[model samples]
Target chain A: MTIEALGQVNVTESPTAGSRSVDCFEKLEQIGEGTYGQVYMAKEIETGEVVALKKIRMDNEREGFPITAIREIKILKKLHHENVIKLKEIVTSDGPEKDEQGRPGKSSIHGNKYKGGIYMVFEYMDHDLTGLADRPGMRFTVPQIKCYMRQLLTGLHYCHVNQVLHRDIKGSNLLIDNEGNVKLADFGLARSFSNDQNANLTNRVITLWYRPPELLLGTTKYGPAVDMWSVGCIFAELLQGKPIFPGKDEPEQLNKIYELCGAPDEVNWPGVSKIPYYNKFKPTRQMKRRLREVFRHFDRHALELLEKMLTLDPAQRITAKDALDAEYFWTDPLPCDPKSLPKYESSHEFQTKKKRQQRQNEEMAKRQKMQHPRLPPIQQPGQHAQMRSGPNQTIHSQPQVAAGPTHHYGKPRGRGAPYGSNNMSGGGPRGSGSSGGGYGVGAPNYPQQGGPYGGSTAGRGSNMMGGNRNQQQYGWQQ
Target chain B: MAANFWTSSHYKHLLDQEDVDMVNPLDKEKGITLEDFKLIKMHMANYILKLAQQVKVRQRVVATAVTYMRRVYTKKSMTEYDPRLVAPTCLYLASKAEESTVQARLLVFYIKKLYADDKYRYEIKDILEMEMKVLEALNYYLVVYHPYRSLSPLLQDAGLNDLNMTQLTWGLVNDTYKMDLILVHPPHLIALACIYIASVLREKDTTAWFEELRVDMNVVKNISMEILDFYESNRMFTEERINAALQKLTLRP
Candidate 1:
């Protein structure tokens, strides 16, 4: 299902008094619903620009999107860019957004029982790359494929170069504008990379199919290569009809990676022997069927580029710049213009989907009149992490929420790594000034300038899950 | 922070340096002005850099902090509350959001040392209290997009190719902390600008490579000039000069 998202919906309609009820949003209808929330096709009553509105019900004390939503608002406010989807604004019957100044500057029009839920405003978009490819009549010639790849690389180039790894680099994450431009959307899974990165990253980012091998083997310390690996998967999927390494689970995903990329030989890849979880698989393994063998009829240049990108050793895999610079891409057959590609009118289901949303929203609004029993106002701090099993148990030991840091709760580690520091540094509670005055002040030494920062060495620090003997390198894409 | 040219803070706040007004927070328009963001910028830098500094992560993490700060302030006004409070709050949130956790205590302590007063503010107890408020105000849009991730490869493409990661990498990281440059150009453009400028200073033959590339020359030049201007004003190198110019302002750090 597809929904629109964009920035700059127009001030004319949003602030109007019943020029149309909030219904100008047209709440056309829902296109899809997922684990966290449901998405709707909405239109601005003023300019009639369509947008996708994702509404997540904060039914429990544990829901984090409220926090995530606020954080996204904060960052998107400043992150103005062409390749990124603009978060125009956020609306909610959740009472007026709390003034940052505390009660000092509360607005008068806020909190009239009519408003209580939250609604995030984004630029309306047409379709995502994956969905575009799924269109019944949509077809890409070889040049068209190259064009999409170039755009993808260009967008990724903007992201990775900015030190952000869109952990989820699948086609679904890349949205295409009607103008033939591609914009990267959904920062819900993205993170900014700091030069002084130390605490091992968590294994929680990208979905399983798009996950890099290092992350699959539980290595928190990884970089843009992880995203590149996903892009490689997406590129391959663009060529093939289905997902590249459609592993139902983690182990299966790892196995599929080993099947390709020649299974981590000590020769092509060194240091593979050092990971704590580096399980010694059969040394005598078969080479991955090269792109040449699988495709059978792909242009040699395309095959060659794909092969290099999906290389087992991430260090050797072609980078976004290299892919763009590839002779195959720049050769006699240049990429096709994005505009020349045919676009399909949204299915009737798209329109019907809009009307259904209106009915459902009215039902929700009526139910909300009495204050939903399921979503009472969060008057106080709410309990988080119901997934907690007796403080500090193995996250993997439990079946779900396996991505939440791999630390043992309770007493901090003694001279070893801090407890549950898989995603953090001290394993102490968040460095927030929860009590009142800024607590982190004057504690850590100020960052000095000149050469590299002093804390750059923290990369090798002991992590909650740092000691895996086998650092699995699944090169499953392409 | 993938290359959206218009909505970014870069196009929003990068104004020509006019006389800065501490009392007037709305003065920061022009691509991205720093004075209006003095509270937010330094607070975010100290909070994020301190956290990342303590954690020993990459400048990538620090850069992420700046990105989050800009992200939060984009749709928000500094007046609803002090950006100082929002700064650390955003940093804490960004840390968690980025999956580079700096315990709440550590972040608070760092803020106490860097921003708050010792007699009334450093009570460790007080800063922790501010956390919830910070979360409430931001409405929790914690995820951020930054430029540090893109710089490395763009330099390679521009033919200014292959930066000395040790120096250039950190240099690019430092540039993010200079101002919210991440809000304007995409991360790689900033990286390219940084590398391109370094090449010019080093007297390297970068012309052949730069000329062969296909990009907006104005964007490259604009990014380079911003960095240069920031470099000239840095306290690390020219505090003596800047301090003389900034002696009139006696607001909180």
Candidate 2:
């Protein structure tokens, strides 16, 4: 039942007014990370209820409380829905200060000085839509997709009815549990909007991929239709294995959208040309709305709903209420009950690992560019030089073999060899030396040191040895 | 949720007269009578209004702050923490809750200006320290639904949008914050009582509108009498009289 029905007739006095503190919970393993802080899996010590604890990072925030957190807490405190993540309460851990060995250290001296150890307690969920979709062998059936979409719309309807905008609704922001209950989470960006102040809202919201065209073209006066556009994208993504339109940047994102949904014009989107970025870049002529052609497997009812949701005009877009009342939901093979959906361990760990690996690879490539300046730029097959010619050049690109006096000379390893063998030798001193030289101080030292061992066979060998050492040091650095 | 007061926290957490007394039992031991409490609250509400003005916030924010202060006192006793401190802290929290967002420094500065006398003055840290206590006392139910929200819609429905009557009704609604009417009664009834009082003062005929509302006429009559009692006390007890009553009561910070 709903809180309203109970609130009306019953005079059930609340047992207590304030939130119970963190002593009621015991911290567990880290589950996920949010934009501002880390989320951990925790357990209610007394009730044995599993919960998600989001630690609010309060480093250097001289302002008493972050407005983002305050807004989120205030909004979440009032919101209660099965499909919306319930914020149980704000609990403070203010733990005893610990030494490096994890023993409690100095309880009275300075332990209580640190203030921000507060955590937002929420109902624990096993999976998010992104993690579910990205699982290696997982494929959502039509009924399952329908079930998830219904829940999404229901949650959105509740928020919109309550005058709140879930400004950042995307696949990842939609969390799910083992029972397949999809809930809207991460309300850090959500805000309660009033009708009188709709025009002055910020446009820089929602993920770029799921952002609506109106927001992209900078319309602060937009409404619930903005969230509807994201719903359409999520729906399309659910039908297809991949995102329907995965644009790399803002301009390209808009282009990718126009290519699929067809270009907006006066007839389709009145006053479309008036948006600030409309004339800056011209998209090709309409491809005639390929949503039907792209998702030919979708039934007629589903396609009709998708078309209404992806409507170019904000005025024409389907609202969450209308979407909930769509004929598609009432058709054959109706949405599966949330509790009946198949259960699986969340694969969020694998997704996080994949992203971390991708990031490490990019970092290694950057370090390679900085270390091997003498090595000619190896361009990929179809790439142009201008693509790699950005302003982020490392100043440590120049070759320098300085500080020979301080160098504990070791056997020279083969040039361009792997880093492990190089580290076995005395490459540490050379690594530090060249890094110092790369900053220009070692450049002058190289010439001054080159004089002491010059004009001899040993000196020439030392030069080659120094060059090899530099390469080995750069390799070891990676 | 702001538009739906019935389902909001205000209705769900409505307290009776006994419940309010149970929350603050210590006030009875301190010899603070119910009349003296009303006068103290009215003065503090004025102080909150002045502080909100210095920060240039809307009346909605001030009203929310006053409601928060009143709710806090319902759970805490005046002798435990000075109203002088809790009053400004409520405004500080309410400003943020209502989205007006006055900076802590600005709030403290304005508060210092409002209470220039040493007996009532406070530092910025004092207000900040009292904020958490006030929040805890309120049980984090920051959302407050005031009768002012009902005043506009009810007036429009009644076709009684006369300027003088509206202004009088609004002021009377503001004064209701000093009474336990917010704690014990629903916002619409309080609004209806304000309208009834204003109608009687202006000699305007709103009996048909009241009858059409279908609300309990007895409840409306009771709420109006409560406000009239405050007005009677306001005329009878001057500031000196209220101060003498306050002196008899023991208070602590």
Return the lDDT, model 2, position A215.
79
- Model 2 misplacement above 4 A: A1-18, A95-114, A195-199, A271-289, A349-478, B1-12, B21-30, B241-253
Please give the range of 10 consecutive residues that has the lowest summed lDDT in model 2 chain A. A402-411
Q: lDDT tens digits, residues A378-419, model 2?
A: 332322111111111222332122111111001112222111
TM (chain A), candidate 1: 0.62
Candidate 2: residue A296 lDDT (0-100) = 59
Clash counts for the predictions, in order: 131, 0
In model 2, what is the error at residue A456, expressed in angstroms?
A: 50
Please give the lDDT score at residue A278 for candidate 1: 57
- Model 1 TM-score (B-chain only): 0.66
Residue A287 lDDT, candidate 1, scale 0-100: 50
Q: Whose DockQ is greatest here?
A: 2
Measured with C-alpha atoms, the lDDT of residue A417 in candidate 1 is: 29
